[model samples]
Target: MTLKDRIQEALKGALKRRQSVEVSTLRLLLSEIRYAEIAQQKPADDSKVLDVITKEAKRRRESIDAFRKGNRGDLVAQEEAELAVLMSYLPKQASREEVVTAARQAIEAVGAKGQADKGKVMAQLMPQLKGKADGKEVSDVVSELLATR
Candidate 1:
């Protein structure tokens, strides 16, 4: 079965189990996938499904951050619950060490000598790390590594 199919199945299961967070998250995900398909004029492949899930997960994380800053504990908790449900559909995230190692390789491949070459390194690295690591985390790691170079 495709990732979309798995998500659909999970949505059905969540509905059966009356898991509100999972049910809502899955519904939103399917809705996003449907929109993407409509926009692309074709069914989304697994990678595209993952891209949608990743985008939703990122949105949840950002919402959680904003809610925390606003001192809205209830909103933060709700966003966190949704994020957890979204995360279940994503692949295992890359560890900091893995990101660091890959960043190092990318830097070398791109001949990035220092901070000035950050963009070049990122251009080379992001595709390799796509869906496996958060872009912000990867950027931070690359900046730290470049600073020390």
Candidate 2:
């Protein structure tokens, strides 16, 4: 099944299992997906749906961090729960080694030989690593690689 379909199925499963937290998170995700579809005026493919999921996951992560910083343990826990739910839809994250390898390959592919080629390297790398690796991680790896040249 597609990611969207899987999410819908999980929502139904959550409802049937009386999983309130999961149900709420899934519903919010569905609403976000619908909003994106309506805003774009086109049906979202699996890749587009994954993009929405990734965006939602990022928002939850930020909320978790903010809540922790504010000493709101309850809110932090809630956000963490929501983040866990959202993360179920994402593929397993790439390992640090994998990201480094991919970034090196991307730099080579783009002929990015020095720090000045950061943008060129990043543009080529981001799409390849999207959803699979964190942006900051990828950026750090790319920067490290570029700095050595």
Candidate 3:
């Protein structure tokens, strides 16, 4: 089944199990998917739905970070729970080694030298890493590679 259908199915199961975090996270994700469809003026396919889910997961991560910084442990835990739920709908994440290897290749392909070529390398790398790796992790690897160069 498509990712969107899978998410809907999971939502129903969450509701039946009375898993509030899963239920609420799924609801929010579905809403975001719908909004993206509307904004794009077209129905969302599986890729588009995954994009929406990914965006929601990123937001949860950001919220968790911000809450932790503010010393709101309760909110951090809640956002982390939501992030875990959202991540279930995404493709398997790339391993750190895989991301680093790809970053190396991308930097070389773009002739990236030092920090100056950061954007150029990113432009070449992100599409390859999209849906496979986290952006921040890939960026960190890229920066580290350049710093060593």
Candidate 4:
């Protein structure tokens, strides 16, 4: 099944199970996916839907951080629950070692030598890591490796 189809199935299952939180989370994800489709002037493919899902997941993570900083434990828990639901649809995340290994290859391919080449390395690297690795983490690993040179 496509990612969208899987989400629809999950939404139906959530409704049947009377899991209100999951139903709502799935609804929100569907809405985001629709918006993304509209923005692209066509229906999103699985990877595009995954991108929308990933973006929503990232936003939820940021909100959880902000809520924690503001001492809004209640909001934090809600966001965390929502994030968990969203993540159920995404592919498993890449490990740090995998990201570092990819970054090393990217640096070599781009001939990136130091901090000034950060942008160059990232541009060449992100596509390889997209949806699997966090951009900031990849950048950090690339920067650290370059620093030692």
Candidate 5:
């Protein structure tokens, strides 16, 4: 089955289980996927569905940070719960060590020589790490590695 199919199945399961947070999260995700499909004028493939999920997850992360900064514990908890639900659909994330190791390889492969070549290193690295790692973390790793050279 496709990723979209899996998400739909999960949504059905959540509904049956009466998992409020998960049911809502899955519904929102399906809505987002529909919007993406409308924008593209075609049904989204698995990669497109994954991109929508990733975008939604990032939004939740940002909201969680904002809520925390505002001292809104309730909002933070809600967003965290939502994020957890979204994360379940995404591929396994790369660990920090894995990110660092990939960054090193990318820097070498790109012949990146210092902070000025940060873009080059990232360009070479991100595609390999995309979906498997967070962009912010990967960028930070590349920046740190380049700075030390």
Candidate 6:
């Protein structure tokens, strides 16, 4: 099934299972998808929907960090639960080794030979890694790889 379809199925399953937390998170995700569709005046494809979901997940992670820093353990826990639900729809994250390998390949593909080529390397890598790995992590790896050359 497509990611969108999978999300809808999960929403229904959550409802049937009386999973309040999951249901709420799914509803929020669907609402975000719908809003994006409306705003863009087009239905979102699976990738677009995944982008929205990933952004929401990232927001949740940032909020969790902020809450923790502020000593709001309850809020942090809540965000963590929501993040877990959001993450269920995403593909498996790329591991550090995978990211490093990919970044090195991207640098080579783009002929990025020095620090000055950071932009070229990143431009090549971001599209390959988007939604599969965090941008910061990918950039860090790319920087490290480029620095060595």
Candidate number achieving the greatest TM-score relative to the actual structure: 5
**lDDT per residue as tens, model 5, 27-104:** 999999999999999999999998998899999999999999999999999999999999988899999999999999
C-alpha lDDT (0 to 100) for residue 115 of candidate 4: 86
lDDT (Cα, tens digit) per residue for candidate 3, span 1-149: 88888889999998999999999888988899889989999989987887787778888888988998899999998999998888777889999999999999998899987999999999999998788887999999999999999
lDDT of 1 by residue, 1-149 (tens): 99999999999999999999889888999999999999999999999998999899899999999999999999999999999888888889999999999999999898888999999999999999889999999999999999998
lDDT of each residue in 1-149, candidate 4, tens digit only: 78998999999999999998899999999999989888989988999998988898899999999999999999999999999998888878899999888888988998887889989989998988788877778888988998986
Name the regions of candidate 5 deviating beyond 4 angstroms.
none
Which residue pairs overlap in candidate 3's backbone? Answer: none
Q: lDDT score of model 4? A: 0.89
Worst 10 residues of 4 by lDDT: 128-137
Candidate 3: count the clashes.
0
Worst 10 residues of 2 by lDDT: 128-137
Q: Count the backbone clashes (under 3 Å) in each candidate.
A: 0, 0, 0, 0, 0, 0
RMSD of each: 0.9, 1.3, 1.2, 1.2, 0.8, 1.5
| CA lDDT scores, all candidates in order | 0.93, 0.90, 0.89, 0.89, 0.92, 0.90
Error of 2 at 37 (Å): 0.6
How much does candidate 2 score in TM-score? 0.93
Per-residue lDDT, model 6, residue 50, is 88
Q: Kindly indicate the candidate among 1 and 3 with the higher TM-score.
A: 1
Model 6, 1-149: lDDT tens digits are 77778889999999999999899999999999999999999999998998999999999989998998999999998899999999878889999999999988888788988889999988888888888888888888888888888
In model 4, the Cα lDDT at residue 134 comes to: 72
| TM-score between candidate 1 and the true structure | 0.96
